[model samples]
Target: MDAGALAAALAAARRRTLSLFDALAAAGYDDPARLPRLSIVNPPLWELGHAAWFAEWFVLREATGSSPGEAGGASLLAQGDALFDSGRVAHAARWTLGLQPEVIKSYCGAVLKAILARLSHAPDDDAALYPYRLALAHEDMHGEALLYTLQTLGAAAPVEEDVADWPAAAGEIAFAGGAFQRGGDQSRGFVFDNEKTAALLTVAPLTIDAGLVSNAAYLRFVQDGGYDDPGHWSGAGRHWLAQQGRQAPRYWRRAGDDWTGIRFGRQVALDPAAPVRHVTLHEAEAWCRWAGRRLPREEEWEFAAHSGHPGFAWGQLWEWTASPFLPYPGFTPDRYREYSAPWFGSRQTLRGASFATAPRLRSPRYRNFFTPERDDIYAGFRSCAL
Candidate 1:
């Protein structure tokens, strides 16, 4: 990309970073004293601080001094690392923490101001450039996580003033598989270290749904007793389904004979016509099997995603893929060792974006992962013919 282009993209990204935090502040962190069960969505205060601190750590610290605020900000981030870092704690503990909301918000505000000041100097300096890119992208991801967290916590739907109409569903496009490029091409501007390289993989002929699996389609599975059939689930998935007594999608509530789902903090009629959100890999796979279809593999998912419209609604919800979340050939961890290495082989990968995904954060090569048993994520899947 040209210098002028880089400057423009970075400027656009910076604006998005601020907007993301503003949205978080509006999400209203629940009163800690009156909190509910533990979950991955922490109070908005904690989220705000983490977002700012991540930017500060990567951008400001490297640009000015390694020490956060001349005294090392690690203390502020220490106790909460296991709680908020995606790589550490279980997703369910976010709601159970005892953090001081006011302090977190103030600290986050301070860090944001500092980082902005540092950005004014050298917007494209490599040290400033790379980490700034990482920080913005990182915040973009957390923005999506924060959205899912809101749904998990039953917080109010994000107050989107000009809520763009959901894209007219892109009818599924047909892809005849052959040799295809998988993963990121570094020539593009900033991508996560995890998505930095490309690999060649051959794909078999298959047909993927024109669009993501719809809630209406998933409801058919529910109506058909998809959740109760062991034949429909993997062994571990079946075990987990039984353990959780899951009878429907994670947030759905049965009222009399109808189904309602929580959206943006309000319970509404489950839109059967809309794509299903918040499903697990097990549920996705089971649904596919019951329908005589199979989940698309990771390569197929990427091929379809990139093949589709460039700016599709990918950031709306994490789309499930048939592939496990493992490193590409010869994958190397950049400075952020904690980003992707630890979770390798342990997590199944998801592609596409969700409602909470930051506009700046996604690409064809982005990889999202969760354990097979995890059902609380902002995830759903698409299917392909055998």
Candidate 2:
């Protein structure tokens, strides 16, 4: 991207970051006593500080800073490593960081200003802009996570959903699949290392949903006692089901004869026509079993997406694919070495983007992954005919 584009993106991303942070603050999440103590989340104050610190560390520090703000160079903020270094801080420790909300916000504002200042004169080249994209992508990931955190905490968030006038979801689109590139090409401007060095994979002919499975479609499974019948679930899924016995989607609750789902803390009636969100992979797979269908493989999903199926809709929620998150052949980590190398094999691959996903982060090739049992995130699935 050009310097102007990078600067604009940084500014917009900062606005998003602050908007999310402000929402959480208004909900009292910024207070240490009121902050959530979940393993899947970090304290809001600490989270924002780390995001800003990351930008400064990657973009402003001396090129040879081995240990963050150590022998390499001094940080823009005093005790930066002691306060916000995620590499050294454990999950539980984030809550005890004792950083005040205003201090963190000030730090965030300062770091963004510094980044924009540097970007104005920076060379408009990929190599020079790598750090800027890296920081932006990292913050974008946090922004999406913050949305889920808001949902998890039942905090009201202002979200604009673009699901209206979506493509028709009534039928299936068949593809006569063949050998195809299964991941991101290294030649792209910016791509996660997990998608690097696109590899060839064999995709069998299959028919997939024209759009994601809808709330009404999934509701039928629930009404048919799909959860109680363990026969539809895989062994691992059954184990997960045993631990957290649930009758419906995680965010759903029965509303008299119909159903209601919590959207950013608002108890809104479930949109039967809208694609179901927050269904775990297990829930999706069980729904597929009840319907005599199967989850689409990641490769097949990608192929259909690239096939120019005008009705093959997405970007409503992250769609679960029957694929594990693993390194591709010749995969190499980018500058942020810890990004993709750490989480492999343990999580499932999700294609497409969620409603909370930033426009810059939404791409067909972008891979989103999470543990299968996690249904707090805005996610759903489409299926293939068995």
Best by TM-score: 2
* Local distance difference test values of all predictions, in order: 0.66, 0.82
Compute the lDDT of residue 111 as modeled in candidate 2: 84
Kindly report which residue stretches of model 1 are placed more than 4 angstroms away from their true locations once superposed. Answer: 1-31, 37-39, 63-102, 123-127, 161-172, 308-315
Local lDDT at 193 for model 1: 60
What is the TM-score of candidate 2? 0.95
Report the lDDT tens digits of candidate 2 across residue range 1-386. Answer: 67798788888887887888788888999886787689877887777888888888888762323254333566778898788777788888887767877777888888889888888888877778877888899898888888788888888785542233242277888888877777776674777889878878788899999999988888889999999998999998899999997888888888789889877777887778888888899998898998999998888888888777798888888999999999887887766667777889999999998778989899888888999999988788999999
Q: TM-score of every model?
A: 0.81, 0.95
Q: Could you tell me how far off, in angstroms, the CA of residue 86 lies in candidate 2 after the best superposition?
A: 1.9
lDDT of 1 by residue, 238-287 (tens): 88888888989887888897888876567777776677877878888889
Model 1 is weakest, by summed lDDT over 10 consecutive residues, at 63-72
Task: Report how far residue 383 has shifted in candidate 2, in Å.
Answer: 0.3
